[model samples]
Target: MNKDKVICPCRKLTKGDILKAVEQGASSYKEVKKATKAGSACGKCKKQIKKVTKKALKK
Candidate 1:
């Protein structure tokens, strides 16, 4: 995925943001959400956030 791709439009968070959060110890969707507030708004990005979180953890 494009690192610049916006994963959470509600929070204007990009994929890079999530990856950085993962690098900073956010190992789960909930943790990522808490760290970056990515999916905390409309919640529509929950699925994408979870997907990114899982992918990041595998690395």
Candidate 2:
């Protein structure tokens, strides 16, 4: 994953941030949202967030 990639522009969250949340046991979109405040804004990044989480889980 791109370390500099900002997944949630609304909250200025990055891919690393999302992964951190995932590493912390956030296995779903809702759980990631609660952990990182991502996909909580305009909702544009929700899909990407889910994708990121899924990728992480696959590993």
Candidate 3:
């Protein structure tokens, strides 16, 4: 995935941000949301956020 790609437009968060959050110990969507504020607004990105989070944690 493109690290620079904005996965969450509401927070302007990129895939790298989510990966970084996971690397920093965010093991779930909830934690990622709290850590990076990625899917906390509007909620449209929640599904994508969960997908990213799950994929990151799998690695």
Candidate 4:
């Protein structure tokens, strides 16, 4: 897990954190943030969150 994948560029959440939350069943922007503090910052990671959520939902 790269601690530098930058899941949320705004909140500075790495991919590992986000993916971990996803694995735990976080299926939305709010869930991601709540689960891993990913978008609790400037909010620039909205796009990335949505994308990850979409992918996660597919699984």
How far does residue 9 in candidate 4 sit from its true spot (Å)? 3.4
The superposed Cα distance between candidate 3 and the true structure at residue 36, in angstroms, equals 0.7
Candidate-wise lDDT, in order: 0.94, 0.91, 0.92, 0.75
The C-alpha stretches of model 2 lying farther than 4 A from their native spots are none
State the lDDT of candidate 1 residue by residue for 2-48, as single tens digits: 99999999889999999999999999998999999998989999998
Estimate TM-scores for all models.
Answer: 0.96, 0.94, 0.95, 0.73
- Measured with C-alpha atoms, the lDDT of residue 2 in candidate 2 is 88
- Measured by C-alpha RMSD in angstroms, how accurate is candidate 1? 0.6
Looking at model 3, report the run of 10 residues with the lowest lDDT sum.
37-46
Arrange candidates by lDDT, highest first: which order?
1, 3, 2, 4
lDDT of 2 by residue, 15-36 (tens): 9998998899998989999999
* TM-score for candidate 1: 0.96
Worst 10 residues of 4 by lDDT: 1-10
Of the candidates numbered 2 and 4, which has the greater TM-score value? 2
lDDT of 4 at 48: 79
Worst 10 residues of 2 by lDDT: 1-10
Task: Identify the superior model by TM-score, candidate 1 or candidate 2.
Answer: 1
Error (Å) of candidate 3 at residue 6 is: 0.5
Q: What's the distance in Å from true for residue 29, model 1?
A: 0.5
lDDT leader: 1
